[model samples]
Target: MPLHSLQRLSPTVLLGLWRLSETPADLWPLLPRAEAYRALLPATADGKRQAQWLGGRVLIHRLLAEAAPAVAAAVQVHNDPTGRPWLDGPGAELTVSLSHSGAWVAAILARGGRAGVDIEEIRDKAQRLASKFLAPAEWAAAQAACTTAAEASTHYTLLWSAKETLYKLAAQRGIIFKTQLLLGEFEPRAAGHIPATLVLSDFETRHCICYSQPSPGYVLTYCHESPA
Candidate 1:
């Protein structure tokens, strides 16, 4: 299939029902060594990235196979110096990123430029780790958005997802989220646009990033020229 078909399907719709039944070992042969490294990560902090890598590849492979025939035989996958992955064969124009927490894996793919995605389960785990990545303003907004610690946890997870997506996008530009990335207020809106800010210190620039709550209890985000 052409890349356009895959682009037309909303990431929410694609990810909403997507599930993986096979293990990384089952799909590693179809991917290159570096690609396989991602899937082979053990279920530990040190291995989480590897898991994300593997999960993203499997998710992309399944989505592409369902979306286009051209993807099946020649969906060449490659990695940047930073270790971000990309498709580089017959359908090389497709850009994708994947993140998984627990049993669920989330992926985003689009033609041209770059795409990123992340998913998190709403729980206290997010709060425990909030201070590590979230800025003070983000914590304040999250606290104001939720009345209880549990709600605060969910809010933080959403913020983390947004920041992560932005981090992946920034990686394409050789930027890092820590120190280099900053976020603004959390606008409460659904579907259309929720206000947030992303500051890239290296470039000394800030961008108004749009966030979308595409599904109940979940946050989804992306960046690219309005889908052609």
Candidate 2:
């Protein structure tokens, strides 16, 4: 597939996805001018990291270009002290997050609101680590909902994604994930919003959130201010 022929999803809630049909090396010329310059340093690195970084950059630029062209010019990416990527530019009002696993990349972009996103590669080990991140009630509920190990694993991964999204949002306030972050049980109900809770730091807060199973094998949770 030619890179220019890549699939583009219709825009919704300030989010977009792009599939990179070209190898990392082939993408250099396709990136926006400023991104092409930053990608050059990654090329100097050993091949593995070079490919990883380049692929992420290309996906980010493509999604930003398609979703919010006016703010794309000021879409500067910077790393927090802990190395999480964030935007710091003229369009600082935009809240954006990106996640990728395997070949696909997903990005969430919000204007005048805070947003967070996470994508995990499903695996069995997720069950083993559940105790550390999940509240006791969450653990029991997840176990009861799943009859098979795979089902249980998927449920746990979704819970983890919720906590991760909370983590990123809390980072804005300099809160720690392990201690400050908390999540409630996963109540997958047919009516109304799915029930989940979050606590950022010692303060209990209510967040209006939404999520979707955008594709098979992955879950996406997004927390942001309700549209005004």
TM-score of each: 0.67, 0.76
Q: Model 2, which residues run further than 4 Å from truth? A: 1-13, 34-52, 66-68, 172-179, 187-194
> Across residues 113-152, which tens digit of lDDT does each residue of candidate 2 receive?
5566666656666678888776677678788888988787
**Candidate 2 local lDDT, residue 96:** 65
Query: Clashes in candidate 2: how many?
Result: 0
**Which runs of model 1 end up more than 4 angstroms from their true locations?**
1-17, 22-55, 66-68, 172-179, 187-193, 201-220
Q: By TM-score, who's the top model here? A: 2
Question: lDDT of all predictions, in order shown?
Answer: 0.57, 0.59
lDDT of 1 by residue, 1-228 (tens): 011113344542233223344455554664544444554344463444454456566567766676556654567556767667777677676666766665456666665444556666656767787777777776677777888775676667666777777777666474545445577664555533334445654445344444554345665555433343
Best by lDDT: 2
